[model samples]
Structure formats: structure tokens, C-alpha cells
Target: MFDIKQYLQEQRQLVEEALRQYMLAAEGDFAAHIETMRYSLFVGGKRIRPILCLTAARCVSDEPDVDMLLLPAACALECIHTYSLIHDDLPAMDNDDLRRGQLTCHKKFGEAEAILAGDGLLTYAFELISSEQFLGLSLEVRLRLIAVLARAAGSLGMVGGQFLDIASEGKEIPFALLKTIHRSKTGALITAAVQMGAIGGGAVAAQLQALTEYGGAVGLAFQIVDDLLDVTSSSKQLGKTAGHDAGQGKATYPAFFGVEKTRALAIEAAERAVAALVGFDERANPLRALARYIVSRTN
Candidate 1:
């Protein structure tokens, strides 16, 4: 039997440790800003993205040392992700006061500093990717991974999603439109995470295709679950504000389909995501578990 919980626990610890290592300490005027940025970056979460990267790398390779090799790259993804959250929570954006069970970055550090901190994290992410440690991979592979990361984080991906999300605010957005928004916003980078791992681990052809499908399915499912949790869960339970989506007049699956249908959709998405990894060996089991956990999580 696959011990999904045990694997997740161990991986979570590894990701947390890696995040701590990635955080740079500031010693001067920007010390407080850096500290606030690090605070949100290290805030407790499941570390899902990095785990997905590590798990995907393991599935297609014979290398047990994949975790050590991919840790920095995985950590860079989190840095980019954290920076997005910090910017997303700004007064001009989601304008929330809480995140990951603590005050939002802008709330803890001034808005200007929070913005710069986010910028700092985003730029630092690419630096980490290009660092000497990750150079163990072929230059071609590293370049490909960097290109993928850049596109996933760029205007055509996450940023474009945010743009549409903001544009759709307070409007009656169609279900299809909402899906398009999420595919770019949440799905693109997630799929990239899986792809990056495969590239980093030297996965070729069919193995890479399977993992990409797996990532795409879960990426959408992740959003569906978030929509469900907004209605069914409490802020304290979620470790962040719940019901904010509806309160903010944002388009969501639940808002259009109702909670019952949305929950069903999440389950279906999760199952499909798991199905995509069927041909892979036991190394893919964690990816399967993560797909299930994404929808099942209360937060």
C-alpha cells in the first residue's frame, strides 16, 4: 500500500527546510521589508507545488537524488508563487488583510515595501533557477526549464489570468470565461511545475506527456476545490479568509454552478488527474495522492 500521508509529511518537511534556506536575511534599511516578505513566504502551507515537482521528477527517472537536484528549482517556484500572493493581496488587488493564517504582506510591511518585496522575490526566483547548484543539469535542459518558468510566470500566463480576473470583477462572467481565466491564472504555472520536474529529471516523450496531463487536470481541480472551500469552509479552518471570492464579486465555479455541482466537478477533475498517471510506476503514487488531496483539503 502506498503511504501517501507519510510521503506527504516527509516532503512537506523537506520543502519547508528548502524554503528557509532560500530566504535571504536583510541587514540594512530593507531588513524589515525582507523579513515581512520571508514571513509570508514561509507561512505554513502544504507545500504542494514543490512536492509536485519533486514527485514528478521521481516518477520518470531512476535517480533517487532527484529531490536534492530539484529542491532549488522547486523552491524558486514557491518564491514566484509567494510573490504573486503578496502582490495579489495588495490594496489595488484583492486588498485582503490575511494570508496563510497571518496578516497580508501589505498589512505587515507598508504597501510600497510589500510591492518591492514581491518584485524582489520574483526576480530572485529566476536567479535561483540559474544558480550554479542547478547547473548540474544539461545547459539545454536548464534553458528549457527557465524558458518554461518565464512563460508560466509572465503576462500570457498567471499575469494574464489576473488581468482577466480583475476585468471580470462585478460582472456576470460565464462559466467558460471563468475556466479560461483559471487555466491561465492557476493552471499554467502548475502544469509548468510538473513539466519543469520532468525536464530536470530527463524525462522524455510519453512520460512527459502523461505528467503534463496530470498537472493540467489537477491545476483545474485545485481551483474548483478553492471555489468549493470558499462556500463550505470557515476562514479559521482555511487558515485564510474564506467567502472573500463571493464577497468581492469575483467569478467562481460555485457562483455559477452552485456548491453541489461544483463539489461534484472537483471530484471528477481529481479522478481524471489521477487517471493520467496510470502507466507510471509506484513513484507516481505520490502524484496520485496529491491529486486527491488537492480536492479533499479543507483549506
Candidate 2:
């Protein structure tokens, strides 16, 4: 009997507080750039990645206190994610002015500052993960977590997706190619979040496999929903400009599968995500609920 919303709210507060504390602690010579870094990291978002880490950890164990210890690593993922958004919204990239209902980083702070801020946050994220305060996790576990994160955030993962996106622009794309982009761009980090949570909780092979499967489904579902929202929802409802995908001639689920088929695909992905957690107890209910929320959400 757990209140998933309350748990998510509490964890979001903790992650935000930890992020601010981490940003505030940056004082040695980098004070000027810290504000811009903090601006995007602390800006309003659902904190879904960190919450996924916490919730997945809960599935393997019930140590609520570990959340504080895990906060830095969880926040690291968010930092990388936020950095991607900042760069993605740049004029050279998506040419976007707004994100999450506010001016983009490049808009609020000049493009140069925004680019540096993204770089600063991306590097700082690694520093946080490698810090000594990670609850004395063994080197092997830490190395594995670092590897998972690096691969997901690096050229082989998110970067590859970005490349595919750029290359596919204005071209007639096959559904398979679109799936590859979504899997790499969106699915990798989502998969990494779940893997990191499983690692944080010291999960073994079977549990890790289950969590990975769960993350993969939900990750693709998230992208499909995002594609659908871009066409069906509004900027006000989405908290960012809608139809920007089509406007940019970007390949998307809706563009290829049509809106109705894309919606069905998202629902199917949600069902698969839920099924991935079938082995876990009620401790995993939050993740299951999150899967539903992913598809059901208006924004």
C-alpha cells in the first residue's frame, strides 16, 4: 500500500534539493558559469529519470534511506539529460526558443554560455558519480554503473540517435530507421536509468534483465507518445511548442506510422513495460503506475 504520487513527489523534492546543493558547492573559479548550469538543471521537469532510479531500487529492496545516497548518481543522469535538451534546443539544432514552459537555455543565456553550461553539467555529472560519497559501493559495481552511463550518454547511444535524427531530416525515413533513432536517442538513457537503479540496489542478472526490458518498452513508449503529442497536443498543454517535429521535417512515429497507429504502438509498448515487472512485488508498483502515466499523461 504505497502512494506512488506521494513517493514521486518526495523523491523529486530530494533530487531537486540535492541538485541545488551540488550546484551551490561549485565555488572554486567556476562561479560565473555555475548559474547557467544550475538554471537548466534546476528548471522544472518531471524528474522521471531519477524517480525511475529510486523506484527500480525499491523493487529489489526497501531501503528508503538509500535514496539520499543515491541522489547524486540519479541527479547525474538528469544533468546529462538536461544538457542534451539545452543543446537540442539551440538554433543550430532544433532552433527552439522554449522548453518545459520557459525560454531555452540558449535564449535565456546567450548561445555560448548555454553551450558551456551544457558541457559543464555533462562533465560535472561524471564527477558526481565518481565521487567517494556513493555509499561505499565496490569498484566493480561503480565501474559497471559508470560504463552503463557512459555508453548511454555517449556516441554509441544518445549521440548516435542525434546523428540519425540530423541525417534523416527531410528525407523519407523507413519505420525501422525511425525505431533505431528512438531506441538510441531516447531508449538508451531510459535503459541506463533502470540499469543504474538495479545496480544501486545490487540487483543480480535476472533482476537486471527484467528492469532493462521494462525500461526499453517504456522508453520507446515515451518517444512514441512524445511524437503523438507533438501533432495532437498543444504547446500550452505540452509545455513546449508542438508540431516542431513536422516543422523541422524530422522523422517521427506519427509521420511514418500515422497518428492512430502510433497511439496503438504506444499502448502496446506500455503493456510490454508493465509485463516486464511481473516478477517484482508491490514495491515495483510505482514503476508500473509510471508506465501508465507515460501513456496517459496529457503533456
Candidate 3:
């Protein structure tokens, strides 16, 4: 069996090093602004999105050195994800003080700087993908990755879902709308992470479709687990405020189906994600493990 914990540690270290190398310095004129951005990017988390991007690339590629080729795109995904988190924790959004066990960007650096930092990170993601300096990727692939990621992170996807979430808060939200919120707000980027990886690896149309299915299911499962953790885990364990969803009257799987049923639903989603990988061989084992890990995680 694959040792997921060890694999995660190795991949995390690899990605952290890549992030350090790729990260822009906080020097020159905009020092404070860059420093604010640096603070959030370095604050610790699992780095799941980038790892998924790399692993998905590995799954589709037979080459031993495929990770190196995909690292830039993976880092780009992390930038986008980190930016979303920064914006999500703002007072106008989720309105909490903690992320990755540290004060949120808005709380530590003030709202304006945090907003700018988030904007900087979000725009920088595209810069990373589109820049001529980012080598080893064809222009066509880079453009396609840029387009896909833009849609996932933009108005019709994560941003739109966030709009719906803020709009529906305190209202009696139905299950259908709740799924929409989860799929758009959280699921789209997750899917994009895998999709971007597949694109980076030069996957075929069928492999791309299969990974999309896996990404979508796993993304839903990840959100459901997040909702469960908010209710069941402590702030210390979660690295943020617990019960925040219910306190804010945010719709969640547990809110709709209760804890036990929500747990079952998460399991189902993970199963779907794993099932979607049946077309691949043992190269996909890491993804399978990751999908299963989504439900078991405490934070």
C-alpha cells in the first residue's frame, strides 16, 4: 500500500521549495504590500491544491521527471487558492480572524492591504502561467491552462458561488442551492487543480474527462468534510474558528442532512472520485488515497 503521509510530506517539501524559489521578493518600492502577500503565502496549510495538481499530472504521464515540468502550474494553482482564502477571510466575506492557525491577512495587516495582497496574488497567478519566463510549456498549453483557471476562479465559478453564499446567508436555503454553492465556491477550483494538472501532463481527451469527474466528486467531498469539521472539531484542531458556518447561518451538508447523513454523503462523493480513476493504473493510487483522505482529515 502507498504511504500517503510520507508521500504528502515529500510532496509538500517539494512544493514549498518551489514556492520559495518562485515567490517574488519584498524589496523595491511596494515592500510593505509585498510583505503582506508573503505573510499569507508562507503561513502553513496542507498545500493540497498544488499537490493535487502535481499528482494528477503524474497520473497521466509515464515520465519519471514529470513533476518538474508541472511545478510552475502547480505553484500557480496555490497562488490562486491562497488568494481566494485571503479574500474569503475578509470582513466582507466569511469574516473570521484565523486561517492556517494565524491571524487572517485583513486582521493582521488591515483590510486595505489584505485586499491588495489578495488582488496581487490573484493577478500574479495569471502572470506565472502567461510569462515567457515560465519555460517547458507550449504556448497553446499555457493559454488553455490560463483560460480554464480563469473560468474556475472567476464570476461563473468560485466568485459566483461566493456571491450566492453571501446572498443566501440567513435564509432557509434548499439542498439544491447548497450543492450549487459548494460546487462553485469550493468544487470548481478543486476540479481546475486536477484539470490543470492533466493539461500540464498532456493528457488525452478521455483522461481529461475522467480526471474532471474525479476532481468534481473529490471537491464536493472536500467541502462536505470542511462543513463537518466546522461543527465537530475545535478551533485549535481546525486551525480556525469552529462552528462558523452555523453561527453565520451558512448552508452546509450537515445543515441539510444532519451529521451522520452528511458523513455518508461525503463518503459517497469520495467513492465517486475514486471510481472515476478506474481507467488508470496504480499511478492513480495517490489520487485515490487523497480522495479517501478528504473524509478522514481533522483539519
Candidate 4:
């Protein structure tokens, strides 16, 4: 049997080491600014996006150094994810004081500094992906990867979903709109991570399609589990403020379908994600385990 926990820990270590190597060092006149960015980047959290990126590459390729080849892009994905978390925890956004059991970036460093840090990380993500380190990839492949990241992180995806989430607060929204919000805000980048990895790994058209389907299902499952956790788990268990969704009157799976049904939906989505990889071989087992792991995770 595959040990999902072990897989995650090992993959996370690889990503963390790469992040430390590739991330900007805090130095010189801009030391404080860089420190704020590094603080959130280094602060603990599940490095799910980058893990997904690397795992997806493994699924599609047999190259001995595929993971190393994709490390820069995987680290870039983490940078984008970290930037989103920092901005999401801002006072103007979720207003949370804790993240990964530590003070939120804005709370520890100042609101303005946190905002700039997010911006810096966001921009740095592109820089890292586009740097000469990634030139090993074909120009066309590199461009596609960059485009995928941009579209997922831009106004049409994560940003747009965030806008809808904030706007829908304290208001009853249709189930469809709520899904749109979740898909864009959370699913877009998650799917993009998989897509980029598939592209980098040279997955053929059919494999890419399968991975895209898998990504969408896993992403949906991830958000559903997150919503359920907000209602059922304590802040200490979650490493962040729990029940904030209810406090802010945010639309969530628990609020819409209740905890039991939401939990079932999450499981169902995870199953769908696994089913999407039926055509793949043993190399895709990690992706399958990851989907199941996402729904079952408590924090």
C-alpha cells in the first residue's frame, strides 16, 4: 500500500529545499522588504501546489531527472501560492491573525509591508519561471507554462474568484455562483499546477486531458474539504482561524449542504479525481493518493 503521508513529507522536503535555494535572499537596502516576503514564504503550510506540479510531472514522464528538471517551475508555483496566502490574510481580506499557527504576514510585519511582499512574490514567480534556469525547456513549452500560470493567477481566475467571494459575503448566492467562486479562487491555480507539469513532462494530448480532468476534480475536493474543516475543526487543529467562514458569512460547502453532505461531496470528488487517472500507470499512484489525502486531511 502507498503511504500518502510519507509521499507528502518526502515531496514537501524536496520542494522546501528547492524553494530555499531559489528564493531571494534578504540583503542590502531592501533587506526588510525581502524579509517580509521570505517570512510568509518560509512559514509553515502544506506545499500542495508545488507537490502537485512535481507529482504530475512524474505521472507523465520516465526521465530520471524529471523532478529536478521541473524544480524551478514547481518552486515558482509555491511562490505564487504563498503570495496568495499572504494577501488573503490581510486585514482588508480575511483579517486573520494566524496562518500555519504563526502570525499572519500583515500582523507580524505591517499591512503595507505585507501587501508589498505579496506583490514581490507574485512578480518573482514569473521571474523565476522565466529565468535562464528554465531555458532547458523548449521555448514553446516555457511560454505555455508561463501563460498557464498567468491565466490562473490573474483577474479571470484566482483574483476574480476572490472578488466574488468577498462580494458574496453576507449574501445568499446561487450554488452555481458559489462553485464558480471556488473553481476560480481555488481550483484554477491547482489545475494550472498540474497542467504546467504535464506540459513540462511532455505529456501527449490524451494524457494532458486526463491530468486536467484529474486536476479539476482534486481542486474541487480540496476546497470542499477546506470548507468542512472550517466548520468542524478548531483553530488550533487547523493552524488558522476556524469558523471564520461563518463569522464572515462566507458561502461555503458546509453552509450550503451541511457538514455530512459536504463531506460526502468531498469524498466523491476525490474519487472522481482518482478515476480520471485510470489510463495512467503506477507512476500516477502518488496523484491518486494525493486526491484521497486532500479530502481526508484535517488541516
* Top candidate, metric lDDT: 4
lDDT of 1 by residue, 1-299 (tens): 77777888999899999888866776688787678768878877777888889889988889889878888889988988999889999999999998878888889878998899899999988888888766667788878888989999889999899989999999998878899899999998899899999988888889899889998999999999988888889999987888999898999988888988898999999899999988888878888888988888878
Query: What pairs collide in candidate 2?
Result: none
**TM-score of candidate 3 to 2 decimals:** 0.99
Task: Please say which candidate is ahead in lDDT: 3 or 4.
Answer: 4
Give one digit per residue, the lDDT tens place, for model 4 in 1-299: 99999999999999999999999899999999999999999988799999999899989998868888888999889889899999999988989999999999999999999999999999999998889877667889888899999999999999999989999999999999999999999999999999999999999999999999999999999999999999999999999999999999899998889899999999999999999999999999999999999999999
**Candidate 4 regions off by >4 Å?**
none
Q: Arrange candidates by lDDT, highest first: which order?
A: 4, 3, 1, 2
Local error of candidate 3 at residue 233 (angstroms):
0.4
**Per-candidate alpha-carbon RMSD to the true structure:** 1.3, 1.6, 0.8, 0.7
Q: TM-scores across all candidates?
A: 0.96, 0.95, 0.99, 0.99
- Pairs of residues clashing in candidate 4: none
Instruction: Kindly provide the TM-score of model 4 when superposed on the true structure, using C-alpha atoms.
Output: 0.99
- What's the CA error at residue 204 for candidate 3, in Å? 0.7
| Residue range 1-299, candidate 3, lDDT tens digits | 89998999999999999888888899999889999988999998788999999999999998888788778788888888899889989999899899978999999999999999999999888888887768887889889899999999999999999899999999998889999999999999999999999998989999999999999999999999999999999999989999999999888888888999999999999999999999999999999999998889889
Candidate lDDT (C-alpha), each = 0.87, 0.86, 0.92, 0.93
